[model samples]
Target: MSFSQFGDKFTQHSGISRLMEDMGEGLRTSGTIMLGGGNPAQIPAMNDYFNQLLMQMHQDGQLSEALCNYDGPRGKALLLDALAKMLREELGWPLTAQNIALTNGSQSAFFYLFNLFAGRRADGSKKRVLFPLAPEYLGYADAGLEEDLFVSAKPNIELLPEGQFKYHVDFDHLPLNDDVGLICVSRPTNPTGNVITDDELLQLDALAQQHGVPLLIDNAYGVPFPGIIFSEARPLWNPNTILCMSLSKLGLPGARCGIIVADESTITAIGNMNGIISLAPGSIGPAIANEMIVRGDLLRLSQEVIKPFYQAKVSETIAILRRYLPEDRCLIHKPEGAIFLWLWFRDLPISTETLYQRLKARGVLMVPGHFFFPGLEHEWPHTHQCMRMNYVPDAEKIERAVQILAEELEAAFKN
Candidate 1:
């Protein structure tokens, strides 16, 4: 008649819940501009390629049967093989189908992963997910089955020239305690679009290795696919690392396919979990994406099409923001990759939540900075004065939103 703690926590109204609901609604009031969602940009060329993939499948009469069948929890064998080959040949990672597993999406994969490494351990010891960066991903904040499942290090703010800044891992403050079950991070970070560099990753990997915990790389927006990353950071892989990838950024969010690359033992356990929980990963994404993997079109398209599509937008948005926002009062993080720009409003009169509301009433939507800093019960005041602006919208609309943001933030600062 009541509910378990998991049920209660999952049902609790939170910022992430609001974000998910907004993403699903997929529409704004007729005049309102919504810029909070993380949906991939709709590139016409990529759309054509996707349409072509389905059209060919339909012509070959492969669509109906694929839809009617269960692919098992491990996902399509052919896709796994394609991914395995790509990882081995391109990235030089020693891998095979045995090292790969599939899930509904990166979200479901993390739900499995966080609980897999963390959660209640034997002897009543509670393991935790260690995030070297505090403002990692809001979605992961509530992912673990245990309420106190995460430990995070507050980052050192590295302000750059031209009103830009970055969040560097404060390794000095990173807690490498024995209870840390895993090290997790998202390259091309979701809210801030900060790509954790190779040097930074190596240090974190070394820390994880020393602690005997696996390094979990959430590559939902990183290497070997979609390749939306604009940083010089290389796509990384190692036997001790867990690489989680998704097809969502490849313009196939509806297909709900996520691939996990790890050691065979972990892959086997994940496969079992997938079977018991989901019965099988959806067949649609693997069936279509496998061809792109085999033919090398996915990589080519990402390099030539996808990367530039978002990169241009990032450049455009930076120009717009730099023009409107006061140079000293506003700070924008370098849009290293991903479709969002992170802006910090220094010493504003009101919190970002209140700023979000004001902008919402003015027909603009943005994610407040407060929602991004999870697991850190205490934080710098700057944490509450930032906003993540999804730049995937039209240039005109995004510029409009930026103008509104600058005006509102400037007015707030004066007051």
Candidate 2:
């Protein structure tokens, strides 16, 4: 059976599922060492917290009300208020319930922001959005496409010694137009795992203000890992800035809790849009998230267990890369606070897609850089040189996967 046509806007779109399909097929047949996804190792806290929430509701004889009640589109008051306090304490950002809008996940927060701001010009022309090259998260491009906004990505500018693999945003070289609506960047960026400096954020804020546009920061990986240090938020430099955060990376994706904090006008606009689309985030989701923060389980777990565990894993993975791969042949980024590594095969002769396929054949897998680009073919002609690898897997898996990846790279280079 043929499926009906979607809207014209969707014609040029490709979802993450398509990218995953190729990787999944390889893994299914070859039992490959998979590292393409950015999912955290485990979120047992969320599972336990959710169970406790259910038990409490059942015992209180409020299970039906808790599960079926429609909450305010803005979110449950308790969660928003608790999050406000957490934000102020954790990131030192002054906020309140009126400034936060809860969504299903940070991904939904991106969607809401795009829809809210990516409207046509006064002449009915589409606006363009700028994104960093080789971005850690892939959903931002998808959201931009869904809203019919053009996406322009600058090269991943390096900011490290010898400029080998460090990535930064060069605002001066960015192609800014009057039709540009927003600039989306991630703090402690995904895939690359590099953090933006305060000066860089300040410059970006200045640029956004000069253009009279908003800057959206995806802070999915800003929490301090064991040994690494990174900036956690944009210094209160721009009132027009919108910070999108998720509990997913911090051990609560299942809580389906994410937040968007902006100035009052932007928050109200997004809250209204969310009401029209999602009605409200389910009541229980916010309540459990609120409870986790209020009762101190979330903070305690993040500080005590999650931070050290992931930090060690990341450190170990970097050591393995240093041991197995040649320093000049393979380019690597030392991440400050995220779970993935961006590897560029500068000396390899093969394309990234071909290398990815070869690695899958040899019992390994990773995301080719092309999938992160919005219009893949037009925008990522040189993507064959790059791939994003996750280090959040178990120690045994990481060791095995890194060995396989190194072996595949050696073979690819020899060929």
Candidate 3:
């Protein structure tokens, strides 16, 4: 039998699939230094805290609920209550348990949202999701069910005095047209680690409001809960916005838990979708994370422990890059937050994809930049000249990977 369009689209060998496969297999390869994945490193304090909690639950015979029983499509009632309380107390948002929904992970959450707004609308015209940042998350490239369902505006590149760069939304190029079904972006962006400022977010919200479209914020690596953010960009929520968050970065990716908060109607739609698609969301992640949220422990731990851990890693990695890479030829995006650093090689003799293959042969792994540019229409040279490296690996691994990358760059330049 021939496969349907949906099957074909979903089964396609896309960048995201290759990335995930490589990441999963790379960890088992003893010699390879993995600098490509978005996986969060295990932190001792946080791991201990959660392990103790789980042990306590096991001791009290309360582990069965999370392990055996399936929760509602909206997820565990207690977890929902805890999230509601957290949002209400901290952000002063008029949110309740009814306003929240849970999913398998932020990836599944985005799939629902992307399909919810885009694809076939009431009219014959297919509406599209608009991303304000071009080189956005690689996961988003295949999230949509429909082909050509995403459009994006190129960012205004701001080069600093140092060999650093910033990516800002190019408002002049952003379209406020009827074809757009929604606007979406990742806070503390995935590939570049550029956090979209409050003013920029507010403006995007305003534009969405004006166009009667919802602005979706993928907050998987943002402030408050996981609190990976380093910049001044604070977490936000409004009736005009939809915030999707995850427990992955909090060292719970295995639990496969994600949360979504939005307008009541949208929340209901998402819940319905979750019910139909996933039967019910996973219970364990929210079960553990909710307690952390309610007790205010998650925020404290992230701010005090996780933030500093990654920050130090970023600092050391940046220093190593500075020492190795030729300053006149290479530039790195100043990492505001997140696990990865974006490195740009100016006028490289080969494509970043080719460089990725070379690095793979040399026992180093990194994501090529071109995979992150699916939404951008124009051919931007910068997109082909960059790579994203995660600095969360052990110091020795990172050092070795950086040195290999430096040598690769020199060789590529000479060739």
Candidate 4:
């Protein structure tokens, strides 16, 4: 059997698929230490809140309506209106329901946004999505319908004290050329947890505006809600900025809700896509979140419960890594936010791919770093020696996993 170019491009084995498969196997297989995947930690407090909200919605008959009816492609009007009101009143961003569009998930939203801005153009020209930093989200590597749809620049590696490092946007050599149509980045970036400074973001925004492109900020784990960011970061949006948020990290992945805050034109484009694709975005997440927004519980829980939970987990995981991993050989990216800790095994004898296999054999699972460097045009040895570990697992399990990781690293170094 054969498939079209689109089918072949999407159906081919990819990094995101491997990550999901590993995550699924870890969930189903007993004793598999799940330090892979982007699944947010199951915070009991958040779970309890959701359970209570579910009961309340059920009693009020809101749950049935959400499940049975179809919202417009623009998404639940109430949720959009509430979100717009909150952002306008609280954050002082001029917005309305027209500025917001919801998709089934952030991943789907990215697919639409990427292809919308980039790829084959109407004039037979090709445009690419510019990732200001190289080691971006793995899911983005294959989002484009056209081949070679992304270009990236290497980051300035700032080596911090105590076996830590940070990635800074190399503004000196950013690839903001004519061929680029959109600029995108994930704040509290996945896999690395590196939060680009507010000034850095502003500079990017200015650059994007100058280049006549939209700056897309992936806030799946960022401010206002699901506030998993640990460092100081001011939420930013404007007419030229596209801020994408998700309910997945806020203990609602199954609900598959994604939010895009953009200008009216972009939202209309996304709505049209939604109408053609899924007919409409799913309603359950928006339904629950809308209630939370009205009661002011969404930001409260994110700030009070969600952020603290992940902060503690990150701290504990770092401490465990320090204890188990060889301090002189392993360097961890300074975990500012997000649920992951990026580990760079300095000059390991084997690639992280081999190390991943070795660790998986010992009942540990993690994503190799190579998968994260999409659109990187040059070869950098650092990419092969790194991996991303989800720190949301239990402390004991994480400790055991770190010990196994240390052992594997030691063996690899010796070999």
Candidate number of the best TM-score: 4
| Local accuracy of candidate 4 as per-residue lDDT tens digits, 101-190 | 999989999999999999988899899999998789998999999889999989999998898999999999998899999999999898
**By lDDT: ranked, best first:** 4, 3, 1, 2
Query: lDDT per residue, candidate 3, 1-415, as tens digits?
Result: 6799989998999999999889888888889899999989888887898899889877866677688999888888898888888888888999999889999998998899999999897778888999988789999999888899889888898887679988899998886578999899999889888898899998998999999989999988887758787889868789889999988987888989889999899889988998898888988887788667666788888789888888888898888888788667788887898889998887898999999999998889999999988678888888999999988888888888888988888888787
lDDT for model 4: 0.92
lDDT of 1 by residue, 1-415 (tens): 6898878988888778898776555373576788988888889999998898889888877677578899967899988998898888888888999999999988999999999999898788888998889787888988878798888878888989899999999988887788889899999898898998899999998888878999999988887678888889888778789999999998889989999999988899999999999899988888888878766798999899999898898898888887888668789987788778898888788999899889988888888897887777576787788888888888899889888987887788778
What lDDT score belongs to each candidate, Candidate 1 first? Answer: 0.86, 0.70, 0.87, 0.92
Per-residue alpha-carbon lDDT of model 2 for 91-161, expressed as tens digits?
A: 67778788888888888888777766775666787777766444546766666534546465556555355
Identify the superior model by lDDT, candidate 2 or candidate 4: 4
Distance from true location, Cα of 219 in model 1, Å: 0.9
lDDT of 1 at 273: 97
- For candidate 3, what's the RMSD? 1.2
Off by over 4 Å in 2: 1-15, 22-30, 43-65, 89-92, 132-136, 145-148, 156-164, 223-238, 375-382
lDDT of 4 at 182: 98
- Give the TM-score of each candidate: 0.97, 0.86, 0.98, 0.99
Q: Which residue ranges in model 3 land beyond 4 Å of their true spot? A: none
TM-score of 2: 0.86
In terms of lDDT, model 3 sits at 0.87
